[model samples]
Target: MLMTTNEPAPAAVSDGMTEGESGALYRLMTWLSPSFPVGAFSYSSGIEWAVEAGDITDAASLRGWLAAMLTDGSGFCDSVLLAQSHRAVSDQDHAALSEVAELAAALAPSRERQLETTTQGRAFIDIARAAWSSPGLDAIIAACGGPIVYPVAVGLVSAAHRIRLAPSLHAFLHAVVSNWISAGSRLIPLGQTDSQRVLADLEPDVTATARRAAAASLDDLGSATFRADLASLRHETQYTRLFRS
Candidate 1:
């Protein structure tokens, strides 16, 4: 997906900007897309346990479970971390970047959750560096020492590439919610149409959560969805499971 310099410059689109604002849009979609090789398909974020425990049995139930997560659980917390990490990188504040990176890893409620985030984080960095290398991206990576969580990696990359934070936040949250919906759809055995319906229904929630998180400070970082956190922990011991967490 690397754009060659020798190719002709992309033609501009009518939105007063080119496609996804001169390719920033395309980059965001590619990085967050389901096929990005982050192993996102393997992690259910605990939705598998929820299904086994009868917490999510249908599309509506799944919608409610994920709505709470987006608003109060890891979704919101991760968004905050991403927002702060983006700011830190934009400001070239290595200290702040490192702080959020550690916080993101520590906030994981369970070992599986930690693995889910950090494993994907490492993969994201490795792939992005190889395919989309840039001096700014490397600088952000160097500044963020210790464990790099998924959100932090996405945030820093967006910052390094000069992508606007608003769209980046929106795309990141949307991808998270979509992944959860996919997991629930499979666990509950919902039809594809039903799964799409659930995702469409949550559009408003996604937009609201992304907006709130983008403006939030690091001090606002926290998760209150105890049930979801417990679900993640329980997933570790479930004898039969389809997801990593």
Candidate 2:
């Protein structure tokens, strides 16, 4: 998962800039891959609760649930946090970084939600410091003097490595969606093909989410996914819960 000094920038990967995009592509895939070890498999972001409540009993319901997530829920907030974190890192603004982190931490609707984010965030930075050291990342580590949120952890690392923010954000969101899909597949007992089909249906929403998030400021941070938020809150006490959050 370590990106080499020789890796290309890959900013214009789609523009046919072959030289730099290879490294760029590699870094994006590595960070987003399930093998990165952030314990993503353990937390369902309340999807477990959604399943238990019968809100997501099948592919259609699951697709609708996930679509709102991408456009209106924590997805929107996390995307803004990620975008701002990357920008703060680029500008070397530790104060803004801290503010973003603090805001992100407090935005979680429940204790389990906070735990899911903080635990994963810390784990991401832990591996980042150990396996993918860099001056920019080092400064970010020193700045936090505490735990970083998951999106911020990723934003800073990508900024430090000179990975194009667009691709990095795209992959990050995609990874988030993929993990949810993986969870639903297990919970709903969805056939593999049906799961893939649901993911395919989400492509447009994912792109739109990224587009809107990149342009959003902190004031734009809000969640209209009340049911989803309530699900996370209730998930904290579910007696037969299978997920950590």
Candidate 3:
């Protein structure tokens, strides 16, 4: 399962350009592309259940939920895992990578969220390796078996593609927020213009989340979003549902 990349690294940036500027752009596009096949469209991260609970029924509520999630729940946990995974791969510590992977697997509060992250993670790694052909990625894929957790896969790909940590973290947050917002658009029936406005309002929160993630330590990983977790758990028994989680 050794990952192999045939494409040479992009030519070194010119004197004025920052390191990895081109690689960051390329990686951002890959991660953000709707066609990346991560199956992001299928999971709502429990927003549907929240909406049903009447906890979230408008743009303001959706924004609050997303803010809490980014600061206190899966977003924070995933950021820690992503950082650890990056270090593990950089150090060639396969054991550490596996540990972080397991942590990521356990981080999800519900079955659907667990499945959503891990399934897409495994797919992302497989596809990214095939398309990018990086040996570092190949080694990681081989070490981790076939199914790597999403954050770990993201960290590995970030390293393989030579994308810097800060921008990569921002991209990760944006992707998470975008998925939820897209789900909100359907479940709450927000207008397209409203969706765009909501996204705009979310920028500051997204940037703050990324900054915190960039500075976060493993000690900061605990979550207190009990209501959100309960909703996700209850989603299993939800009689009718639109989103998977």
Candidate 4:
């Protein structure tokens, strides 16, 4: 159960500047919150198949699987795409943005993976534009010429909102990781505390991946998590599926 927090956003501190930062923090929290209308909860990114296959049976195994993802698989790939998209939008380089968008669209290893990302992506754009309309978001949609990939959509809007790439990418990846853990929780029937423990254990991987991605170029995009890919593939045939992927 990935739940949204109701705690108030932090107030501006006396760190030479606090006002400008508060809105960014609040926007990130709201945009990435579990309650955000992205249908993120409906897709397990193949975790259902992994659990069914006994590949993720406990917190330790779940952490290990997700660590690989954050460092070398879809997690890392999405980070790079997001970073590159952010930079592209910030630089106003429509060509680069379009290239990244095309690559992201073609990179999904499975049809369901494609569906998961594009569906959430299109939703993100429609929702964001309605609430936080910006030329940057419109630019990404124009470049994409159709549905946007999830990370690219987030990157475009974050840039449009003038949010820094580092924090935005980190937040996006964290949400992705949390969604996966939530799926694992329900599938493995793991306790809530155990689920949280796995999330805590993956913080290092998340931070390291985010840092690496912030400085990465399009060439850095690639996924090596073969089993994770296979899991999504196998999930297509998983008859008792509780997830779309």
Candidate 5:
């Protein structure tokens, strides 16, 4: 008989400076923590639609779909936005910051996708201000002058706290993956062990994607995750679903 375990792959050691001059690292973790009231659990990013369509029926299929998302779809686009926001914040380039924030919000393919990013983003900013107030949050808010996306808000807060870009991006990407895995576990009804295994298998892909995002610019952004995008659009009309997409 086969057995299962919840053990995860060992994480790579940090680059040491991630701790920052103050409590930057801890706050960064708090902002991205699964418990963060972003309502991330409510949206499946169209994975629900895909699952209902039989595109993700098992662990292997879930893993494959997730891998493609991390590398090319909304995941890649969000990473780029996060990376740009990090740089813009670090430079205090308010114009660039606002531009990217607007672009990120506008690029959402469907109404649900827009709601997913913007609502979570608005909640993130509000909760952060209430509990983790900082000058950085204010700066980003004033600069943005409009709606924020989840990743952009995170980037601004991290930059304000003097957190280094690499680890910030790494943590942000990991949170995105973790949220998906959590959604997959429920939607796919995978065993905890299988979910953990899928996350473990994605370790390298996540790291590489973050690294590439750090070096990428807006011009480098594009998505070939066509099926995923369509699924997100279709989720708008999915007859019965457990997620809001």
Candidate 6:
């Protein structure tokens, strides 16, 4: 079993430091940085398979598919898991944390999706431990006997970095949407302008979804099923693919 290390608690904030101060911006940026070594760049989350199947071949279709995914698929499930993980870590409730971790691991729609999330999650946990040195994080790592799902890792780091749930959720959704759009632009051969337009249009939906997710509970963790899951499972055997997922 892999385990996180425990370090000293965060230092007390200096006088005059506001909760919304610019100092938080640096922490947020570092968390969302592409070079953070979480290895998020390698997974397409089965979008590549969708494109190959002609189910998502153009900008409009890609946007629609991604919107559905955000509102109904992994994004929703991940948000629920992240919120639960945040609460668990905040309260130091190890049993609840383990429950959330197990749910997150089981929520993956396909083998590749499972591997992608768990692999990146473990990597992210390791990176956070080495870079931030938080005691709470170390505890979570120590408890990680099973695969560390990505959303759990994200929540753990967000809590360690003192990022609030709302912005943290937004960042998580934005990262997923942005990565998929980046992959779609190349896979579907979408024009740069079109890709930008799709991203712009998605901003409102992403924000709304984040808000919805913030308010969701574990009981609400359900998906549309069939399309997303079937496509992902089929992607496993897709030939001549540009993506590993």
Name the best candidate (by TM-score). 1
Between prediction 3 and prediction 6, the one with superior lDDT is 6
Q: Against the true structure, whose lDDT is highest?
A: 1
RMSD for each of the candidates: 4.0, 3.6, 4.3, 5.5, 8.1, 5.1
Name model 1 segments beyond 4 Å from true.
Answer: 1-15
| lDDT for predicted candidate 1 compared with the true structure | 0.88
lDDT of 3 at 59: 89
Cα-lDDT of candidate 5: 0.84
**Whole-model Cα lDDT of every candidate shown, in order:** 0.88, 0.84, 0.78, 0.87, 0.84, 0.79
Per-residue lDDT of 1-245 in model 2, one digit per residue for the tens? Answer: 22233454434547565545576677678878999899999999999999999999999999999999889998878998999888887778998888887788788888998999899888988887788777767777677656688988888888787666677778989999999999899998799999999999999998999889889999999999999999899999998977898
TM-score of every prediction relative to native = 0.93, 0.92, 0.89, 0.92, 0.90, 0.89
Report the C-alpha lDDT of model 3 over 1-245, residue by residue, as the tens digit.
01123345444567544444655676677876666788988888888889888999898898899888888888877877787777677677888877777767777778887888888898888788777787667777676654678888898788666566677777787888888899989998798888878889889987877788767776678887888888889887899898778
Model 2 ranges with Cα > 4 A deviation = 1-19
Model 4, span 25-95: residue lDDT tens = 78889899899999999999989999999999888999999999889999999999999888888787888
Tens digits of per-residue lDDT, candidate 1, 4-30, equal 233455666786665536688788889
TM-score of 6: 0.89
> Alpha-carbon error at 141 in model 6, in Å?
2.3
Return the clash pairs for model 3, or none: 2-138, 3-138, 4-133, 5-133, 5-134, 46-245
Instruction: Per model, state how many residue pairs clash.
Output: 1, 4, 6, 0, 0, 7
TM-score of model number 3: 0.89
- Compose the digit string of candidate 5's lDDT tens values, residues 133-183: 776568668899899989898878777666777878888888888889888
Q: Evaluate residue 127 in candidate 5 and report its C-alpha lDDT on the 0 to 100 scale.
A: 90
| Model 4 local distance difference test score | 0.87
